[model samples]
Target chain A: MGVIFLHTLNRMRGTMLGWGLSLAGVAILFMTFFEDIATQADTLKRLMQSYPPEVLALFGAIQDLSTPQGFLGMYFFSSMPLILGIFAVLAGSGLLLQDEEEGVLDLLLAHPIDRAQLFLGRLLGMMVVTAGILAIAFAGIALSTQWAGIDTAIVELAKSFITLYVQLFFLSAFSLMLSLLMPGRSTAAMTSGLLLFVAYFINSLSSEVESLRQAARFTPMHYYQGAQAIGEPLDWGSLLGLLGLGLVFLAVAWWRWRARDIRITGEGAWSWRGLLVRSRGSSA
Target chain B: MRSIEGNAKTLDDPMQIPAIEIKGLTKSYGRVQALRGVDLEVRQVEIFGFLGPNGAGKTTAIRCMLDLIRPDGGELRVLGMDPRRQSVEVRERTGYLPGELSLYPNLTARGMLRLLNSLRRHRADPATIESLAERLALDLDTPIKNLSKGNKQKAGLLQALMHRPELLILDEPTLGLDPLMQKEVLQILREARAAGTTVFFSSHNISEVEEVADRVGIIRKGRVVEVLEPESLWDRSLRRVRVRFRKAVDPQRVAEAPGVTLLDGSDGTSVVLQVTGEMGGLIRVLAQLPVRDLETERPTLEEIFLALYRNDEED
Candidate 1:
């Protein structure tokens, strides 16, 4: 288990650097713009009001657009799930299929480790990276708010970041589950990534169309942001639901992987839309 | 229908634990059956060669012994332990180099081996790793993705050989290696065998198997067809001898000779003979015939192996 975790962490070192820099970089960049926006708060507030109601959904229904946390939440936290979801899904999908595709899973499995250890070890590695990347984002926002002369509570912003981590964790767990069950890497990645996009899209659309209001409850994105958790309390119901479902998915992934015969290639390439779309018997 | 027998470890008992034992093993993926009733036993401290072409279930049979894949039916034991129920225990004493080898692309060869070592119950000695790296001439510091195909294979072999387990299971160990490197690897296997490691290796290269294997098992389409000592195989082997006569020779005369059977009617002045016994009598007989050109081609190990597969196909 230690080896699997270390090996997987080594593989994702470059990814952690890339995503960490970009996401945190974007957060800092947005905060730097906040000071300028705060001065012209009146003009920006009027402009935001002039836009359509659907456009306000972009800021996650934040009423006070003039404040620093409001601006950061609108720009950074709202789209956090979108970016982190894909990253987590890729990590989860890669936890198995990456080694499977490269044909190294056979080498790893030849050790005195159980199939459960393989899944758990790699999952632990991905989870650690997720936490580190999220911490970077959280730190970047907390400090940038200070440098920008904002009076927002650091603890409150940290709370919002926690929710963001939960959302990404759910996506990652679901993706790992799909990777175990699906026939190919791209199938798992694309399916989970596509689900994230559709869920986010539906959550946004639920704001306008009252029909999708209750329907949005079924989407993973629904539990992600508790209206940015700016001043309001954390939604414990959504939090538990996301955490619960993630564990369930991981459990299923383990059971399926432990019981099944793993094929290195072919038979699962034909994703709804993915790389190497071929039918069965293509492994030869 | 087979079940395992318990072994008693006592000084008086003198127990013999076979490295691997399989009885009526069967496995299938979906509708495609990869292994069908494979029954084999590899003795401890013995080198057993498994021969078959690609997709002939060599990999599947080896995996079952390691319990990497569950067999649909049959019983398997490795080192006197049931592989299915005690896979981790079975694997702890085995070293495996897969047919399709892959290492961590991001990590250097040294780092990859370190990771594998950390996970193992028995740690590979640093001296052993260094010596094996030197012997294989593998650069431990280089990232595996940057290495050439042969180099990567050498690295894979290093990881397998580094630990020096009791049982070494290699599938096409020399698959991507050059002839020179392949020879080096075969020498390593020989050395390992001398050190008392049981080698259960599968290869399509007949000569490689012929050179190192004490006994060879020929598997075709997931079934073990034949398991025999290499010496016995050579004893019954026939050599094709072509004798070109200076003058037209009587086909009946060559056919009537001892230890010689006419393959085909004398091709013009040349008689193609299949010789089974000592070449001395056949050569003396050919000498009596005004032989212009003489050539004898021994049946290659590959030809012998394929003959078994071909015979199965015909049936």
Candidate 2:
């Protein structure tokens, strides 16, 4: 388990700089939201009057981006999920595949651990990284809120952030499954990207398209409607749904990994994308 | 099928049981048979070599033994336990180096070793790891990404050997190392064997196997053709003589000769004959022909191995 965790953490080490920068951006937005609540909301409200109602729906009907909940939704939920979703996807894209590429998959599997243990250990590692990112974001948001003299429920905000981070477990699991089943990183990345995009789109479309509201239940992010969460208290149903989906993805990942044969290639001329395409062609 | 009762010829006491025993193990990848009833045995304290070509069943058999892939049919036992049923136990006693060396590039060599060591219940000694690092000339501080290929292999060897398991299963162990490092690795294996570690290694590198292996198993197209003591196999086909005669040799007379092959008598002025088995009979037969120049060459592992594979293909 430690081996898998360390390996997964090692992969994300290269992207820590980018993660810090992105968190900084989120911090700036968090600060701006509070400052606006104190002094700029009135002026912003007057300016926002020019925008159509449809535009509000498109961005999730934000009546007030100045309030803490509204601000958290706009900064953390609205854009952050997609951004962090990408982070989750990209961070996990090589969790299993990279070992296969390095030709170390055989070496690792040769140890006493089973496929389930390896998968779950790696998933736990990704969960830790995600939890750390969310913790950092929570701290940043909490500090910024206090620094701006906008005192809302920091615990409540932390809870929401924790929930979203928990949601990311499912996203990470899905990405891991794609990483294992798909031959290459790019293929896994593209698949995870498409899945995340579609999940987000379905979550949004669930509100607009009457039929899709129920249909979107199939997607993992359908449970993480941040707009609704900010307006209301919380939704346990969606949380459980995402959690179940994560477990299902994990099971699928384990099963697929058990069946698949990882081809060991060391610094070959063929890139991951090329391998994916080549494998696809060969199979077809 | 029931166990072959009499076939169980114990080479030594019950304490000297093999670390790994594979019998009639078969694995197929769609149309291609990767391992076809390959039987092998690695004695408790000897360095066993599974020598074969690239596509042969060496890797497949190793994977099966590790329980990485389920064999289609046959019996396999590691530490007298079924690999499929008791892989976890088998793996605890086994240290394997994959044919292709791949390690996490982001972690420093020490970090990677520490992590793998943490995974095992019986942690490897830090002193042992550090000593191995020093001996292999591997930098513990260097991230694997920064290390050259040879350094990565050294790190892998260090990590695998650090715990000092009862069995070391190395596949193409000397692939990336220089001659000196290769010699160092061989020395390490010898020392490990001396310490009562059973080393089951796979390689096509003849010299490496010749240097370390007590017994060699030759595999071809997923089948184990032969598992013989290296010395006996080496000595089995040593006597061979080839001669080019000054005058054309009668094909009928050469064929009738005890152990001489009239390879070609069509070149009327120069006859070439191939002889095997009896050097004395070949010497007598060559005396009858007006021999001009003679040359003899020892058959290489490549020749013997290729011939074995070719014969298997024919059969």
Candidate 3:
């Protein structure tokens, strides 16, 4: 298990660094504009009032941008989950599916390691990389807080990043589960990507649209703290719920991986008929 | 059915377990049946060659032996242990080279080998890997993606042999190699056999099998058609004899010969006769014909393979 875990981590080092540096750069860039955004807070607040309340809710309404908490919320935390969710979905869906599709998983499984061990090793590796990337981004945000003279507590900012990590974990696990259930990597990724956006929009729109309110509760985005974590205490219930659901998804993925045959390249494809008639023990 | 009864070990001989044993093994992909009741037993320390064409269940059977794919209905035991129940234990002692080999394209051959070696409970000795690489003429530092097809194949072979496993299951072990390299791989397999490693390798190349295997199993359309010693294939294969007579000859006389069938007689003076089993009777019959020149063509292993398949179809 440790061997597979270390190898998985080694393989993803480049991806982790790329995502970490890009997000961190974005965080720094956003913080550079903090002072200017704060100076125009009053004007911006009035301008925001003129716009439709639904439009304001789309980007997480900035009630008072003059404060560091509101400024960071409106600019950074609001969009962080959606941006990072893309990485999560791609990484999770591709982690094992890509290897299987490329025909390497057969060789790897031929080793002494069992399917469960391989699955757990890769999952743990991805989780560690995800947390590492979030930490890198958080470091940039924390450093820029001093340069930009924003008076928010570092602990408060860390809490927001933690919330972001949980949301990403849920998204990653969901993608991993879908990859096992779906026919191929593209189908899984597309489904996960589409769901992420749809859930975000539904949750965002539900704030003003009464029809989507009940539907929002079903979306993972509803449980995500996002910018709301900046000033308030941690949402333990939401965090634990997302974490628990992620574990459930992971378990299902592991079970499916263990039961089904590993497919050779170009042997199978997505088919509605296949889906309906496919046996539980058969490969897609 | 030609089973391995002659080499079968009994409970009285508990120490001489067959390296691999499969009975009534069946597998299917959707409606395409890959293996249909394949029963085979490979005795210890022998190079067993599985000969079959594309989609003939060679790979499927090998995968089932490794427990990579579950058999729909069958029994499989490797090294006297049930593969399905003790897969890890089976794999720990077995080394497999997949038919379509895939490696981490980004890693150097050495790095990839190291990673695989680390996964084994009994890690391969670094000196053994270096020795195998040198013998195979493989560069340890080249990334897998940068290697040519033959080099990649060499890398696959090196990994499989590095651990010096008790049983080596290779699919197309000689695929994509030059003739010289092919011979080198056969030599390597010979060495493994000499070291008491049971080698079960699948190939479509009949000559490679004939050159190295002690016993050969021919499969077609998901069924094991025949299992015999390599020498018997020569005995059973048909030979074509072209007899050119000095003058027009009586074709009926030649056709009536034992174990001989007149295949073609386009010209009056010459006839093509296919001989099965023995040719002595035909030669004696032809000795009576007007003094003539004769040419005998030995059948290739491929023709022999097709004949076996045809025989199976007839049955």
Best of the candidates, DockQ: 3
Candidate 2 versus truth, CA RMSD in Å, comes to 6.6
lDDT of 2 by residue, B63-133 (tens): 78888778889999987889777878788777888877778777799887877776676467787787778
Worst 10 residues of 2 chain A by lDDT: A262-271
The candidates score, on chain A by TM-score, as follows 0.89, 0.80, 0.93
Off by over 4 Å in 3: A266-270, A273-284, B1-15, B239-260, B268-306
Q: iRMS of every model, one decimal?
A: 1.9, 3.8, 1.1
Give the CAPRI rating of model 1.
Answer: medium
Q: What digit string (tens of lDDT, one per residue) describes model 3 on residues B1-315? A: 111111111234444888898899998876778889999989988999998888788998998888888889988899999988888988888889999899999999999998989988547878788888888899999999999999999999988888878899999998999999999899888888776678999998777888999999888788887899977766676889899999998887898899888899777799998888777899899889884798988776567667656766677
The TM-score leader among the candidates is: 3
Q: Give the 10-residue window scoring lowest on summed lDDT in candidate 2 chain B.
A: B1-10
DockQ of each two-chain model:
0.63, 0.46, 0.70
lDDT of 2 by residue, A155-181 (tens): 677667756876778777888877766
- Tens digits of lDDT, candidate 1, A81-174: 8878889988888888787787888888888898878887888989888888878777787788788778889888878877888888899999
Deviation in angstroms for B218 in model 2? 1.2
Q: What residue runs in model 2 are displaced by over 4 Å at the alpha carbon? A: A2-21, A33-58, A180-185, A205-218, A227-231, A257-284, B1-16, B130-141, B235-303
Estimate every model's Cα lDDT from 0 to 1. Answer: 0.79, 0.73, 0.86
lDDT of 1 by residue, B198-303 (tens): 8899998777887889998988888998899866656555778888887787888887777788887645698788876467777667667787898888776555
